[model samples]
Target: MAIRIKGYKWEFNLIESPEINAWCMPGGKVAVYTGILKITKDDAGLATVMGHEIAHAIAQHSAERASQMTVAQVGGGLAGAAVGNKSESTQAIVNQLYGIGAQGLYVLPNSRKQELEADKMGLSFMAMAGYNPQNAVGFWQRMAAASEGAQKPPVFLSTHPTDESRIAQNPRDLPEAMKYYKK
Candidate 1:
């Protein structure tokens, strides 16, 4: 629960986008969209969204993802090298196919794991930041409702957990988050 955020030069900005979205890039750069403000009606709701995005930066999810991609690229190179004696077409095909398989087998699954990790970390962070973590549930529930009827890729092929899964996880993470909440 002790997260040291003092060293980074953090930048938080409200972007003038109509999309209900938020993101945190590496090195503590964060942006919250104006459209999401409708859902996040107050400070606690806003905290719920910001805490989750901040958790991604705090945990270095972007770095981790880049590392994973680099590894997958290296793996493809190795695979192509193993077929060095083959024709140029054969090597290209091997590398290309390997990239696809690696994305499904390695990259996307890790991305989903990061999302879940951020969800739990976000809860703890919001609580520690003096906002009740319980608000996260309502926030995510609203997100789910907001996205209802939107078509989505199947879970296995997606980079994030389904809304149902995220909503389900919020309550399970609350008890741990409450440990960080004071008053």
Candidate 2:
């Protein structure tokens, strides 16, 4: 990890779910799920997952989402006023729409653009860290398969870039990452 990102390092911790996951916080805080070990299966694959999540942190997606949410809330308040509906039914509708908008703007997985950018940045980070870039494909495939048949909240998947789409694009960015691959 240090090799890939100058200030980053690995930390192990327990989480409640079986989902494979990883994330990096500002100032290089990192955590990787033991469950993800099953899917990653190798250093390179694990690096792919870690790199992508770390890329998200580096890109400050969380902050961007937060900002978006604030804006959405303000907009919703204004829109709600314009609708001039204060009844229970109207309030419920507004709440529902607000929920949907919030999901799309912040809680969602990320846009296609964000996903692609993460892939590109993550691959570079992984390569610089001396991991092979080709492993990204297997990682995404495992992620897609793992997500199958799992019950998910409706608004959740609506905002996220589908795992399948990401898997397809991962390889296309390999050429760029290959330039940085260690060997």
Candidate 3:
């Protein structure tokens, strides 16, 4: 059956892996790693993750990220030239500064925003698809617990929102998402 989200054709792939991860590529291609099923626990939890991934595609997050990276690269080059074109130390500093600045100023924040948007969109999608939107909060909480003690970059340098932040927003978003729930 054709899905409610229109325009692009959707394809799902199941991959065997031990890493708890999933992703949606541009043009509605999606992949779910077997390892994530542990956290998903049930069909509702699975719907939560699936909706989130699909929402990323619906929002065109991949294209926006690529465009942002291109801009950041060009801006970094210009900033480097402005600082110093000659000294090796200056070049190194510029590179480091660019990495910090790009991530902190643009990339990380944009990524977090996209994540939140996807969460909101996903909540609605799952609710409309006959899954309880409230389950999303529990799913994220489980995901957070699963990743505890694992090495992770600091929030400023990371792309996705921190688990605490993601889970915290769910209750706030639940009311709206519930409106779309059919059963």
The number of the candidate with the highest lDDT is: 3
List, residue by residue over 1-183, the lDDT tens digit for candidate 3: 245346687899999999899999988999999999999999999999999999999888999999999999999888888877568888888889888889899988999999999999999999999999999999999999999999999899888899999999989999999999998
Task: Report the poorest 10 consecutive residues by lDDT, candidate 2.
Answer: 1-10
How many times do residue backbones clash in model 2?
1
Error of 3 at 164 (Å): 0.9
What is candidate 2's lDDT per residue for 1-183, written digit by digit as tens?
Answer: 444345645453445566677766655566787888888889988889778877877776667767777877787778678666578788779878877766665556555466678888899889999998888888888878888998755545564566777887888898999999977
lDDT against the true structure, each candidate: 0.89, 0.75, 0.92
lDDT computed for candidate 1: 0.89
Cα RMSD to the true fold for all candidates: 2.0, 4.1, 2.6
After superposition, which runs of candidate 1 have C-alpha atoms over 4 Å from their true positions? 1-6
What's the best-to-worst order under lDDT? 3, 1, 2
Give candidate 2's root-mean-square deviation (CA, Å): 4.1
| Global fold similarity of model 2 (TM-score) | 0.78
| Model 1 Cα shift for residue 76 (angstroms) | 0.6
Sort by TM-score, best first: what order?
3, 1, 2
Best TM-score goes to which candidate?
A: 3
**Winner by lDDT between candidate 2 and candidate 1:** 1
